[model samples]
Target chain A: MSAIGDGRSMPTGAGLFDLPPELAIDTDVARRVIAEFVRGQLRQAGFERAIVGLSGGIDSALVAYLVAEAIGAERLLCLMLPYRTSASSSRTDAETVVERLGCAGELVEISPMVDAYFGRPDTGLVGAAGPEGLTASAVRRGNVMARIRMTVLYDRSVTWGGLVVGTSNKTEALIGYTTIFGDAASALNPIGDLYKSQVRQVAAAIGVPETIIRKAPSADLWPGQTDETEAGFSYPELDRLLFWLVDRRRSVEELEAKGFAPGLVQWALKAIAGSEFKRQVAPIAKLGPRTAGVDYLYPRRRPGSART
Target chain B: MQPLRIALAQTAPRLGLLDENLASHHALIGQARAGGAGLVVFPELGLTGYLLQDLAAEVAMRLDDPRLLELAAATASDGPAGLSAIVSFVEESADHRLFIAVALLEDGRVRHVQRKLFLPTYGLFDERRFFAAGDLLRATPSRLGVGVGLTVCEDFWHLGVPQLLALDGAQLLVNVSSSPGRDLAALNEIGLGTATSWRMLLRTYAQLTTSFVVFVNRVGVDESISFWGGSEVIGPNGEAVFSAPLYDEGLYFVDVDLGDVRRERIALPLLRDERLELAVRELNRIVSERAGQADDSTSEPGAEPGLDVAAR
Candidate 1:
């Protein structure tokens, strides 16, 4: 039976209350459910081909596998982008993912190109002025690399008539671990809603490589840098706190009741509240009577129109 | 021919609160259904909320996310005369990119999804930072016999997407938007008719294309940004059929006859007289000139304008 039919057949009237008696935490079932939904969306959007940037990381690996399962390997293109700071093993991990997924892929080394532009003594050292100079420098450098990669992706998208797919998960997105207009760009994303922990569950169900799945999440922007280390909190703790505060809409006191550290809850709330600007359209002055994001409002579509 | 009843949901979304926003949508959908609305439309990015900058990538969901599925099931169960609505959200792509997306749900399943094709990079609209622009511009086939062209906020402002959809035989044009209020004071100071200019643009498109136009916008405040919700419906003659209140979240319903669109187009005959071949030739000439200009001004190599085809 088709996945849509499978979804439709699953009793809906029960709402969230009617959990099956033996509701096992089946990540595979969830993956299939998510994949089916994404696939249906692509079909609805009239897109058959999908292009993805394959970083040697769990998030990208999981997204690639899901896309393969959803739309098939034949319709997916995995672009492996390795930068100067990238580990040799990163390439191998990416290759293994493409092989396992049986998808077509191309390796693009961004070192020579990145070095030529930013490695120059004059331009490269602008952001690298202090003791923690390299961190800032690497960020600027990473932005260039990310934009370059997107340029390539868009070029390929035009050539192949495919949509560029995104791989960012919920955890990284919460703390602004992504570069604006760089790694954060795509025509659609499938894993953005899943937290890091949730992504691992989905990855394991899809048989993603353990090397990627188990490794500490990092942007691979600079040497010896890890995401959790940079964020100052691990994904498990962060995800748990975020789920409660953002998803559950619980207050600081409610979080304390749930046994979360007061400081941690405060920290999470502050961080989320602080980063609120990153979540919206650019602010505009009210010039007209009806402006988008300002005074214009509508639901998506109304019901019962002419159907062909 | 029966008049097509339409409702617009013009409201701002609370960031990252999926369940709460979904609940709000459900209530609106229920109201639209009960009011005998054949179709309802919401503002852009209504699901996750607009101004979700990077959060769009994080909270973006697949069309089948349980929340969406729940919505679909509700629509299906509420059926055959039940309300169908177009809901917008950020959708994650296979490569981990996000798209400003709109999905049409009828009988509890998504009928079609259209991604925003134009990513405005200037001013405060840094859509290029998050969403990858869409390529296809064809009208999606809806259950309602007529082809419906779905364009998000920015896409309708451009001629390319709307024109392409019209050429492809879209009988109705629906633009879902999350446009934030900007520089109204500047317009007043400068004595510029920005609001009237905007109305003229919408009216011209409706009249020229000889298609019914439905523009839905979001309202409410997110941080310092306030959305001006001016949801409106225009007939084939470029007349305002129905308009919702500004700066508020409310439902505005209108009835339209598809036959009028055909009759208007027949009367106008602009669509029939469009100079497709000459337009392509002019575009090529402009591109060639731009390429020559780029080579001449090689010092400013970064000034190359992105190639954009005007669809409408």
Candidate 2:
């Protein structure tokens, strides 16, 4: 493996100074700034292709479009994987986008593959249960499906010479609504910074399908499932509370004064606080002088500086 | 050789809120243009939040939508000296299947669009439940005097994408991604790690291919998954040129000389020394071994999870 550069020591300010003035206010400009940065990185890294899972959802849709603009559509590869319960409309929507973009695409049914591996009796009833049991059997089954999909994606990625692009976002991250290694896997991501409300804005601007942009958010792991249904709170309310609490680092009391429901606020607080572990890499034991998780914290190089 | 200035736009996105996301893009694009960047890249599914579950189909959009054209126009106007950008979106093909794709805009026109080839189905992802995988490997010629190999996130991990691009003489490889952050507790417990290991592997391949590699990841939480914004750039020699912080939205930029890639390839001779046929055979052997070890069981058709028992 090549020596990975620890960014902790890199100089922090040169690139920001040369940035465009409009970028400060323009969300598109902000996105462009990030895109240009990634583009340069690609040039430096010597990679040539990108691969994304087209889930026919707004998140994946938005990511797909941004990638097309950053690189070229020719270098982009889209994959549509459908399961037995997955709506046909979703696949239709995915195809529509692929055709309009003029990119190449294929379809793979995960049902056959997943069933072949984990649907066996020995795999346990957990593979076929719904969300009602304390066993969380349905969740486990869904997770299996998700991991199986990732495995296929990774395998295909190895064959295709491209990196897997993740499609997760901020709201989900805060609430820990994602599977550990399932949809959470990817080589890179572009929209993880934005909240659920913000994601809708960008999607509309880029002309994502109206249905995708307007529908209530859900993971579709089980029938009639919506994100809010499981989380017990809507995104708008959740985002407001999250911004105040997590982004502002406000105390629970401060959040209550903001007029949020006490119960909801408490829930959000607990969820966010409990999920801190999801935000970091592996914890390190203090054995060496410069343990990555402990003592190595300093800016080393400028943004454009040559590698040491 | 003039260095290529590339920007990775890490921004926030609202679930099912396309209009808001587009406005955000407008702002980000302006920033990249003002920064004198030749190209800008955004995250996979940056236009929409990633946890759409069943709503993915309802919100899928077509490429010819007027809104997309407007974005294209913006790209043409905002770029510096023939500016270009890579934008991610859900495209509706003629056959009506939804595809996760990236569109390249140059001189205000849609240059080329590539669909993702790998549809992830496990964990927090169920792309197979929603999308169609893409086929074909081709580089798009950019006005910037370089041929670029474009692919969405999952495509970059496969060797075929890079091999084909390098074989076709692409100088740069750009991948737009939406990688989720890993849970530290899970990593500690499982010890299997998150996507970083995979990213390192990608960097190694890029070095082997002797082409510049740019990876742009998104940040923030969407549903149960957290998008870890650890976007980075790797040199042809597999050295880290730049990397963004984890879980924060920012525009990361790097300047690179394509000439260096050519020189590196000449010096190392890895691509030349590659035995493609033999490698394919070895790959087959490895795959067969894994498949043989896998447990095989057929799921009963239409075996819906017992919703009654589940609701309990």
Candidate 3:
């Protein structure tokens, strides 16, 4: 948790519970900015191609389209890694995006990796099958599936000759709704700054399929699982609170004054504070004067040579 | 002259988006006005993002454009009292040529427009292909009762523009730029970077001309370049009084003492002791007599060929 000068864990910027109309960005500006970011980040690393894990969700669909626009469809590779329990429509939707954008894509089955670890019932693991040996909890199976999918993506990265582009939006990132080292692993991200609501808006502007934008967001971890259903807070409400609390750095009292429910404010504050670790680099004890990532730092590029 | 409150709106402009960028300018102007600034400055091409290779014509606007007028009217008495702003944008002249220019607005109207004299075409800059060079150089009368000289990016690098403006009774020199940041490692210990050479140049100009220097630069990555937003205000004594954080957007308010302009000039006497007539006559002689021979490596080109160039 951040010990923000006032001992509160929040970022800077302010907003009310009701999403402000001004918060809606000009889509043209967003498209140009994101496209430029993708191109610039790749060019700096001396690469022109990017790979994305397409989940058939709004976030991944938007990212796939943006990357395709940045470095043409020939350079972008969209990989659909679906577990056995994943919905058939999700797979179909992912294929639809690939067809729409005309980008190269492949389906990698993640069922083997997930089932190999969790199929056994008597492991006594946290999310292992119960005494009846029926099934593992949804969280455990989801974590395994996420890690396996990332592993497959990274392995493909070698042959694909591209960096892994991130698909997590600001809302998921702030609430720590992503699996670390799994969906969160990426060489660079273009939409990390945009909130989920803003992501939907930009998706429409950038021609992400109407079906993808209209559907409810889900991690596809288990059957019938959706983000809003599990979280109990709608994205619009959460995004508005985050815009005020994180972006504007409003105090708890200020949020309450702006008509945010006390319980929701506390819950969001806790989530944001608890997830602070995922946002930064792992800390290293500074035994030496010039510790790495501390006093000793260099830019990604230098005069004599490029980084890669 | 009185002490003037100045605000430097260090902002990132979206490339080739005129309407959206103007909206950003308006928002920043409101913030500056709320901060009690009498004058606010924006970065170069603040109204039409930088790196506009071919889009310059698409977004080029005239001084009297209705959108600019709308921005000007923001400083009305309904907000802050007597607020004035200097914002940069691509300008389409009467003849349809485009020039990178800055507009000075006050009392709900554009009071002056200073076009960039030097169009940098080296390294990451390719301004010459898209923008025509401006020939005029002078200062405008600010509502704060001081002559505020305006420049855009490379114009200040020549050393002659600010000097000429100071000689023309300018008390403050403002340069709006879209300088990209490099050598970022050195910026922490010493405020120096690839683009920060302009900062040292401004400091020297402030020391020599005894005028307040205001520089506002944009931040954010564009294509492959990242503009460093180390917008700053230098006192007439060449010391920085206020500087915004690099790589971030902020509207920083600073109080500039115009009295320093008079105080430093009296102490240094650089402008007062200048041999204006001799310098002018010698420049004209060099231009007329040595026009061709100058590039041909003549032994004695100018009327005062043996004279030390710096002494003038």
Candidate 4:
């Protein structure tokens, strides 16, 4: 829908440069791979079902389809965790996926959880609760909403008997475009390897609604907030750059040689480097010879005989 | 040279479910045939599934087992011309020892059986404990004007497997694997996930060997392991022509020209420059020589005692 500004074309290199068409992943192969990943991650974690925080964005919608396909629709729980500021269309779009897939769906307004910390003045829980008690910045409030949504998803995981499936794509994950423990916290992520552009491709191949795919990419943190406009980078352009820079391991000079603008390349590389910590497990000191997450490397399905 | 139509079947095999998996092979072989593929490559232990600790013996199939004949028969019907398949399974050797093996089935019978040379034993892989390692390495010739070299999952990870296959005149290298997707979503230094690294390796092999590499990995979770099915067909130039998705199961097809192998070999003569004889001679010397007792008497002048020429 909203393609953002005139400069948006600069990043995508739509007219100036060509996105390597060959790098566009074969979607049929991607679907089967993701479906198996979902099923495998769940089975390893001893879960037959999955719970996804459906934001009605393309990423979540694609993940929902993959999780449903991996197990069955009946085994999936789609939670529309919306804040008061979340758009009505967000709820409707999420509901559409639930209805189409015939999976269980529930809507839990996150206003109470968020407002409990920032909504009240007497609830002196955090610093910088302004004169009226709410955090002044939209960014700060957005982070709270994200964290609350994750809390609800994990809490639901107990009763729903499913792993929390992540929806963040490779583009966002690389750019540190996701909330640290919020949308990033999941038992298994099937779409994390796919770039945002590839996410749209695989989403279309898997039959996600066109409306969801074409809509302006956003985290819906505040009214009128969109990802592209705020980040000053278009996903298509960013995905292309990331594919070459990260996946292809191309240097900034090589990217420039490939016709990418120098400024955009620097910005993307810095974003990727800065966010590198988010993509890894928290470092654990190896006090012992075989510390967990160190030499004590075991698969998610270890003690395999116990499951039987 | 004729272009080879190859199919990589990235399927999830249920553990020890030989009957069901064989039927699955039958269906997939038909699918590949219908898609005009001359050869269909399935994942490692595709018939028995991975993480088969005790179950490996239960599903161990003999080379002459009737189930294999049925699979060979699936390629019998009218479909693609010169259709053949390399399917992986646990083999019950004549001596009753189990081996992880790939069967080259064509013309309604078993053509050749290539067992896994390296049985991985580290981290999530207990293959060595359950199965015997194979010592032989060779390639099978196809009627479609291409020599097909077959290797089980871990075989390709070890050095020299690709070189050995190429030396034996293999233009196409097919690696069948049931490699579980560990750290499925975790990114490595360059931002590639663990599963994606597998594709990168296939690309490197294809490029270095000047051969078409068909890497078919299984999809689905077995016990606590989830096999990341990113089956791919890498061109001789190391470019990925087709790659199946991360954890899904299906038959993916790619048309690889055997002529490209020749062209690439001519263009980048890595294989042509290979010193196979030198390597063979050195390996023969190393394996045959026994470790001599420490002798300081024949030591070189001004040399350390352990570094003596007599020790060498």
lDDT of 3 by residue, A1-308 (tens): 12345443321122212223434554554565567678767765678888999999889999999999878999999999998779998999999999999999999988766656676444544223344333757776677678888898888887898889988889999999988888877888888878887787678778888888878789987788899999888888888899889767899999999999999999998998999888878899989877766755433432222346
Ranked by lDDT, top first: 3, 4, 1, 2
What's the TM-score, to 2 decimals, of chain B in model 2? 0.83
Flag the better candidate by DockQ, 1 or 4: 4
Tens digit of per-residue lDDT, candidate 4, span A250-270: 987889999999999988878
**Candidate ranking (TM-score, best to worst):** 4, 3, 1, 2
| Chain A TM-score for each of the predictions | 0.80, 0.79, 0.87, 0.88
User: For residues A162-232, could you state the per-residue lDDT of candidate 2 as single tens digits?
Assistant: 76778888888887777767787776667776667656655655667677776667776766777888779
Task: Give the alpha-carbon lDDT of every model.
Answer: 0.73, 0.70, 0.80, 0.79
Q: Comparing candidate 1 with candidate 3, which one achieves the higher lDDT?
A: 3
Taking the tens digit of each residue's C-alpha lDDT, what string does model 1 give over A1-308?
11333343222112212222112123533454456445544543457888899888988898898888878899999999897668777888999998998888987787666665554443445332443333446668777888888878888887776778888787777867777667788777777767777677667657888778778788788777798788788777778777777766788888899888888777777776776665555788989988765656322211111122
Residue A79 shift from truth in candidate 1, angstroms? 61
Number of the predicted model whose DockQ against the real structure is largest: 4
Model 4: lDDT equals 0.79
lDDT of 1 by residue, B1-312 (tens): 747889888876766567778999999998888888888898898887776664665668887688887877667744368667899988877777788888888777888888888988886666786678876677877766678899998887887777778888887889998876542221121212333455677788898888888899887655334566778898989998887765656888788887888789889988889888988886776677566643332233344443343233
Candidate 4 lDDT, tens digit per residue, B194-252? 66678778989999988998888887777545677778888999998887776656788
Better of 1 and 4 by TM-score: 4
